[model samples]
Target: MTRIQSHPVLGNTSERLRVPFYFDENLYEGYESETIAAALLANGVRMLRVHEESGTPRGLYCNIGHCMECRVTVNGESSVRACLTTIENNMKIYSGQQLPNPVKRMVEQE
Candidate 1:
């Protein structure tokens, strides 16, 4: 794992509850205190989602929940920010995909 072993403020990753979560149907381990983006990045898994319009790859950006770049689906909940959500045992996380353009579709139908 590429996690920070020690930090000036957070200190070290003291013993925390190890939780298992599924991402894109693959199993991965994380800590309960970590957000989805942090856990996935620590596990060496980036590219959280693809651009809905262009299908370009996207990852954690402005992790404070403003840019919406780290969006993911959790336990069937859509558009959940990975940077703000805490990990949970047995949680099902699915990467966001390029969704159809609703506005474009409406114009096409007309």
Candidate 2:
């Protein structure tokens, strides 16, 4: 599936910049102003991440960045809100399954 060609309210999306980006190492095109979630949806990629604890499949919910459901890893960073991050050319997106390692504080033996 391709991006929305035309909408009743917002028409003529051709003017927007169509840049290529990588989602899970796969290349896909996305508009400049489009968010990461929008870009993924355009390429028929609904499942972006999974719940860390339950391992449940997840995707876009609130596209306003308020919800963390759309969280994805942009480049090397993790827990980035897909709805808030705009797509850029050659941006490498990830599912954020392997989150950043937490800082471990070494404790003295009691």
Candidate 3:
């Protein structure tokens, strides 16, 4: 189920190799060098993260990097724009983790 078992356009998506990673404390299997958003989407992770203002869920709105709707925090960096970032082995992504302490303090201070 980790690999693309079925697809309309790119039938039976093939990958170079499978790699393990964590997203917000959840372990996920994906291929190396693939976009994190692509791997998440392939595994039915529709909501990458939420908007700060409206709390609206968002995902790969654009496959390319232009839309910025698929923003996520990879390894503590916020607003990573997932569609543009490729997945790496043992990548500890923080898509749904609580905001960083500094950012939380900054927000509270504001």
Candidate 4:
């Protein structure tokens, strides 16, 4: 998917540097200074994590780092906020885990 063509409030995102990052082993690029969740959403990735008990998929909710729905693993660190975490070059992000355990994806029925 393509990045945001132009943001009404932010103007043009093309001015920022396109940082390369890995999400679930897939290569994606996002503008510099943009949050990890923002980048992922722009690239059409909605599922960010899974519930520990229910095994349900979770994505961006309160993008201000309060909802705790966008938690993801960053560089081996667990429970990192995707909405507040900045996207860095060569960063690795992974979902599908409830803390340390891999849970079923949101699309799965069983």
Candidate 5:
């Protein structure tokens, strides 16, 4: 069920070469070099992480990397933004963690 069997606009999907990776603790298959967000979306992943204040669900808003909405931790580091980061074999991604209080304060100051 990891494949988008059907898409409204993309239509009856073709098989994507499976690349192994883990998100949280679940194993997912995606194609190499594809954006992590795109691969996740194709597999019907609607929530990448939750907002800190409201704990509301959020996912890719702008497929492009400009918006931090699709941000997720990769390989123990939060530096790699998912929308811009390409999926690689054996990569680990984490989601739904709050920003550090200091970072949150900095954002509020801006």
Candidate 6:
């Protein structure tokens, strides 16, 4: 993965903190100031998740959070937008088919 040390418009990103995160059990380094998608892309991880229905491979699309193509399970939470979620230290990210009702549960009645 290559990082732009200097840019004409954005300038240098060297000042950003290099935080360690995990993607499917593998360790990788990324800047804490950027989103999870950006960090994954920087690490050459393009395949975020597969299509839940057809089982086709998918990656980042319409990176402004308008598309759900970049959904990834972040730290036990499924169907999280990689483009919208920021990279946190030691984050456990997973890429696979989206699980149904991952955050929902039936309440027990008294």
Name the best candidate (by TM-score). Answer: 1
**lDDT of the candidates, in the order given:** 0.91, 0.82, 0.74, 0.86, 0.78, 0.85
Off by over 4 Å in 4: 99-110
Clashing pairs for model 5 are none
Ranked by lDDT, the better of candidates 3 and 6 is: 6
Ranking by lDDT: 1, 4, 6, 2, 5, 3
Q: What does candidate 6's lDDT look like per residue over 1-110, in tens digits?
A: 66777778856778667899999999989886778998899899989998876678899989999979998889999889999999999999999774454334343321
- Per model, how many backbone clashes are there? 0, 0, 0, 0, 0, 0
What is candidate 1's lDDT per residue for 1-110, written digit by digit as tens? 78887788755776567899999999998876899999999999889999989899999989999999999999999999999999999999999999899999999999
Clashing pairs in 1: none
Candidate 2 residues lying further than 4 Å off, grouped into runs, are: 8-10, 98-110
Query: Could you report the Cα RMSD, in angstroms, for every candidate shown?
Result: 2.1, 4.2, 4.6, 6.2, 5.5, 6.1
| Candidate 2: RMSD to truth | 4.2
List TM-score per model, in order.
0.86, 0.81, 0.73, 0.81, 0.72, 0.82
- Which runs in model 3 stand beyond 4 Å of their true positions? 2-15, 96-110
**Poorest 10 consecutive residues of model 3 by lDDT?**
95-104
- Candidate 2, residues 5-89, lDDT tens digits: the string is 8887756688767789998889998887888888889889999898875668899888887879988888889899998898988
* Model 5 spans > 4 angstroms off: 1-16, 99-110
Among these predictions, the greatest lDDT belongs to: 1
Clashing pairs in 3: none
lDDT of 4: 0.86
Pairs with backbone N, CA or C atoms under 3 Å apart (clashes), candidate 6: none
Q: Mark the regions of model 6 whose C-alpha exceeds 4 Å error after superposition.
A: 8-11, 98-110
Clashes of 4: 0
For model 1, the superposed segments whose C-alpha errors exceed 4 Å read: 101-110
